[model samples]
Target: MSKIYVLDTNVLLQDPHSIFSFEDNEVVIPAVVLEEVDSKKRYMDEIGRNARHVSKLIDRLRETGRLHERIPLENGGVLRIELNHRSFHQLQEIFVEKTNDNRILAVAKNLSLEEQTKENGRAVILVSKDTLVRVKADALGLQAEDFLSDRVVEVDHIYTGELTLYLNTDLLNRFYEKGELSLSELANHPFYPNQFIVMKDALGTSSSAIGIVDHIGKKVKKLVFNHDHIWGIRPRNAQQSMAFELLLRDDIPLVTLIGKAGTGKTLLALAAGLLQTEDLGKFKKLLVARPIVPVGKDLGYLPGEKQEKLRPWMQPIFDNLEYLFNTKKPGELDAILAGMGSIEVEALTYIRGRSIPEQYIIIDEAQNLTKHEVKTILTRVGDRSKIVLMGDPEQIDHPYLDEYNNGLTYVLEKFKDQKIAGHIKLVKGERSGLAQLAADIL
Candidate 1:
């Protein structure tokens, strides 16, 4: 039997097309949700954009018939706006407040009760991205679920972009001798383009060799830039070496790096960008940008001009650049940036509608971005440009996004098969022993 799904405001704010996700079911939108969405439609962020998109979608649907009545959808589902069930008395003993959450709960509780009385009733499930709302719904004996349509993969099963293969001693010797091995010579495995591989001795020996899948997907080739130092920075770990292989290659235009705190993701990306743009002159300029999401409580409005206001958010990028430049003074790095004329650091907000050509672009803290936001950033890439997106998925600050649904993981999963894309998940922390311990235990 078809079930009934009542959506929360956060669901639509996270994804505007969630209304059609419930196939062959009845979708209910509480009137309060529309009110909340309307209030957010005027802002200038991802949430605001989603709110406007939702409003336009619902308005387009209204052309067919009244939203208060059942309107057929293209996915064999029916949608309606619930106008009644705003009575607070039903939940007055437990939840006395007249908040929007309570109003939505009241509607869901009434619908669930009404369904229980019918001879053949459909299940009423409240879908929300808010954990507290789902908890309250459960306390009131209503079925509650999370909006899970946006998740690209489960947290534990996410791709690590590296695989270990135990090979026979003869095959390993042959790979070392020839500097490359055909995929047909190895066991049948699902290997993606530019994926790192560690071939070890299967006979319980200590010998091993590292290789990466060629873009053609038919051969595993030796690392080319493993021995080169990029901008006076060297890869400290095997994964870092794999990352450098992807970053230095001109053939691969898209690279994604994911790791925990202090895993050298940002530092390595900046080093590679500086080397390619300033040293090798491979691109016209090096552009570094990041989303401006604050950690914990926000500081409200910042002071000074655009650059000054952006300093705090972009300080991490500057720190990495300072290390690469060996600068000691406070304003020395800024002077260098101004003198270079080939390097630019800015926020991602102003990147929309701009076509970036022949540049090395790095987007840090990409885990805070939504899928649509990342798509917009990627579409801005012009001819002969390379874009690197690096972030710690476990350290997201966006209220509406989680590790599995964030833009970083979304791109890693979606582009793992493409020849022009490469990904690496750094596991070892090369910053300090204390930082590694904190990352592990804390």
Candidate 2:
């Protein structure tokens, strides 16, 4: 028998196409969900943007049949808007506030009970992203599930973007003796293009050989820039070494770094980019930017030039630069960047329709972006340019995003085995002792 799947507002917001995900099952959209979607539809940010998209999708579906009643979906499923269960009286005994969650729970409970009375009763499952809502459904003996459509992979099993394949003794000797190896030999090596290689002996010993290469037999030489030590920075861990490999590779064109806070993700990318563009003459400029997601407020009404308006959100990028330059004066680093016309930091909002070439682009805080948004950004990359995307999956601020569903995770999961990409998950917190402890305990 086909089951009845009730969708929560968060699930719909996270993925507008979720209504069709149940295949041959019946999909129920509570009337209260439409209210929440309407309120969020006015937003100009990603969440609001997704809300409006969902609204439009549903409206288009209505053209095929009646949505308030039962509408036959093309995928052998029925979609319906349930206004009959708008009352919260059924759940008032347990939840006194009559909150929106309580009303949704009441609908699920009523549906399950009504189905149980019929022959070949359908199973009613409530799908939500909210933890509390799931807990409430379980207490009431109704089936509940988290919408897993967006999760690319399990949290612990997520791709690190870097994989080291152990080579035979002879292969290692040949690489060291000849300074290169054939690409066909690494067919089963489980490495992405631009992936850093640390050739270690299976017997266990030595610092291990470190090198980076492209998929088509081109070697990316290590960067030779002198470190200023202005940011009080160091590699801190092996993952950073891998990150540096991708950062210096001009042929890689695309790089992604994943880690928690204070692992030096953005700092390392910025430093390597500066070395490549300013010191090595490999690229024309170094540009950094991220999506402007306010922690709590919307930025649509903020008034100023693009740079001034973005300053508040992009301050973290500046902080890294200030520390890297080690300038005592406030405007000293700005003058340096202005003199070279080599460094530009802007917002991702206006990146569309722009053809950027021969520059190193670093997109920070990328985990807050959706897969669609990330695709939009990557498609704009011009020739001879490299783009690095870095983010901490645990530190997402997007309302509808989780670890498995965000753009950073999507890229890492989808492009893990492909060439022209490299990834690293930095496990250590190098910011400070206290920062490390906080990342562990808190």
Compare the candidates by lDDT and give the number of the best one: 1
Give the root-mean-square deviation of each candidate in angstroms.
Answer: 1.1, 3.5
Candidate 1 to truth, TM? 0.98
Query: Candidate 1 on 1-442: residue-level lDDT in tens?
Result: 9999999999999999999999999999999999999999998999999999999999999999999999999999999999988888779999999899999999999999889999998899999999999999999999999999989995577788889999999999999899999987887988999999899999989999899999988999888875467788888888999998889999999999999999999999988888889889999999999999988899999999999999999999999999999999889999998998998999999999999999999999999999999999999999999999999999999999999999999999999999999999999999999999999999
* lDDT string, candidate 2, 277-394, tens digits: 8888888988898997777666576678877778888999999998888878978988987887989998999898998998899999999999889988999888899999999888
Please tell me which predicted candidate would have the highest TM-score against the true structure. Answer: 1
Candidate 2 local lDDT, residue 231: 35
* Pairs clashing within candidate 1: none
Model 2: which residue pairs collide? 193-419
